[model samples]
Target: MLRGPRRPLWLCLCLCLLLLLLLPGAPGHRGDAGPRNKKAGSGRPWPAFQGLQERLRAAGALSRRYWALFSCRVWPENCEEDEEALAGTLGLKSDLSVRLHGQHLAGELILRTVRGYLELPRPDKALVLSFHGWSGTGKNFVARMLAENLYRDGLRSDCVKVFIATFHFPHPKFVDLYKERLTGQIRETQERCRQTLFIFDEAEKLHPELLEALRPHLGRQAPENYKAQSLRTIFLFLSNLGSNIINEEVLNLLKAGWLREEITLEHLEPRLQAQIVESTDSAFGHSCLVKENLIDFFVPFLPLEYRHVRLCARDAFLSQELLYTEEALDEIAKMMVYVPKEEQLFSSQGCKSISQRINYFLP
Candidate 1:
């Protein structure tokens, strides 16, 4: 027998218990799922965190990203497909753009602005586009197309923020409150990623003070950092204020027997800006953004003719991945009621109701 100093009998027993607890298949041993299994052991209750982890992984958040790290070996094909979707949408003309029907000017201007933005080392002013036209004339639609092409996740990305005048800031009396909130939102958004795009819809109804608040964000000339930040950010103004004026001009030209091509941006800009001043109660033309020549472009969406409406119906149908024929497209277009019975010239509602109109044709 070895004559070693004997430890306490209780101490020896405690050491054995600890070793057993640490071992696999030991009486008290359990792995990471130990807590999970314990709940299941009694009534087989599921763990919330485990299920959530699965969903996040499926949505390509956690595990998917980790998996993407090794995607070159696992799934290289997906990387090639739509790999440059974001850039492609911006740099090239999309299919929907080709189907823009009567909106060549708007499309060309969008492409020009995008091309110019990409070229600028540091843009002095943000791409401040005021999309002016009647409802469903593709004002919001073009803005959407631009947003989708600019960012991968399209409008869903946090970089894109859309504020509708009626819904987001309905009260004019709270102009100061709205101004502060709007300023804070932009400042916070720009902090995260200066490549932020703010789309203010129904801008015609925005409060004068609120629109004035955007002036600094657009044209800050001092500090290089401020100018750089503003350069990366884009502000899109969507409104229906100048629709009637645009319509009238178009009709007058057509009545005078002038070709559509003759009706140019040169003629429309002054007319639209003048109408914005007369019709819009907000700071549209009155704000420093306008007076200072800060608005980079004023894109007008003109009234859609029958063919244009048909193209819209086609686009809407195709978007839903639905099949259709010329007849169906024509039928939907015909259902649309145009104004001024004499000419029956253009769709009164624009393509705004295409989603609803398509339902009639859909099985």
Candidate 2:
């Protein structure tokens, strides 16, 4: 007994406290909470405990996972939350179909392009999607839909970065500085995340030099050592550059008796490319990106119609759990101004303010 060394007082005290926490019916034990505690129940873990187990299992945290199990054993109600789960094509499709309106082409094209690219075992280049449309026509909405479905945190994810032209780089003299920062940020983000998304809002306002700097990232060659699906990236360019052209083309299609669903990429892509090339006044239109054909798809968001606006209003009301009438829906739709003087076909503001508009009906 003289040969044995004494245990440290603090270590012994900590062990005793841990033992107390695990003992059922002991003071400060997990069972003290109630019958729902794992220690008190009939060998059944809480529903949240089961969820924790499943998530830990999927994450393949074999070694450290026991800590979670042990923690859950002591306190079932306080399991840690896992990172967000990424959605597949079906989930993306369902969200876009349910939440988005009046842009059949945008929904279908975005779904196909994104899903297909994500499935590729080894993509040679980043998936560059250029979204063109008038203000309030779901360009930003579709971008958000893609973000929400692709990453767990959506736009808020550390892997996702958004750059606005007018806001981020308003001065022409600062083009060099913006290009350096932009390129550096892209490289840094890609290095940090296996899959990354970069969104350029008001892309048309981006400096030509800045867009040129992005050419290397969007090119057909992948970054060195970035092979297969180990590194995946998607670049979204949202702009109003070709909105007028999109509106005119859509109107022509409607006048030709073609249904909205019948409109195809063949009808829009070529024209969009041509417009971008012809637009020498804007940085986006004159950028080497357009000339190089680096953009994989130019997704067009069609101007929303009255029916679409009404649908948006209905959704807005339901979202707040507020009761609404057909009259209310009509009133909301009518409140929006339609353009093209004669036919008055589409909502100029799209569904931009429908959520706020519902406030009027809140009693």
Off by over 4 Å in 2: 1-87, 222-230
RMSD of 2: 14.8
Instruction: Give the candidate number with the greatest TM-score.
Output: 2
Model 1 residue 123 distance off true place after TM-score fit, in angstroms? 1.7
Kindly list the per-residue Cα lDDT of model 2 for residues 1-363, writing each as its tens digit: 001123444544544454444446655334221112122234544423422222222222212222333444355566432211122344467667666788889999898888788777667889999999888888888888777656657788888899998999999998888888998899888877778889999898887788889987888874565553326789999988888888899999999999988998888877877887788668787777777888888898888898889778876765665656666778888999998999999888888899998888777
Count clashes in each candidate, considering only residues at least 3 apart in sequence or on different chains.
0, 0
Write one digit per residue (lDDT tens) for candidate 1, span 66-162: 2322343245676642232223333235433444657777877877776567566655667788888888887776677666656656778777889
Model 1: runs farther than 4 Å from truth? 1-92, 225-231, 280-283
Highest lDDT against the true fold, candidate: 2
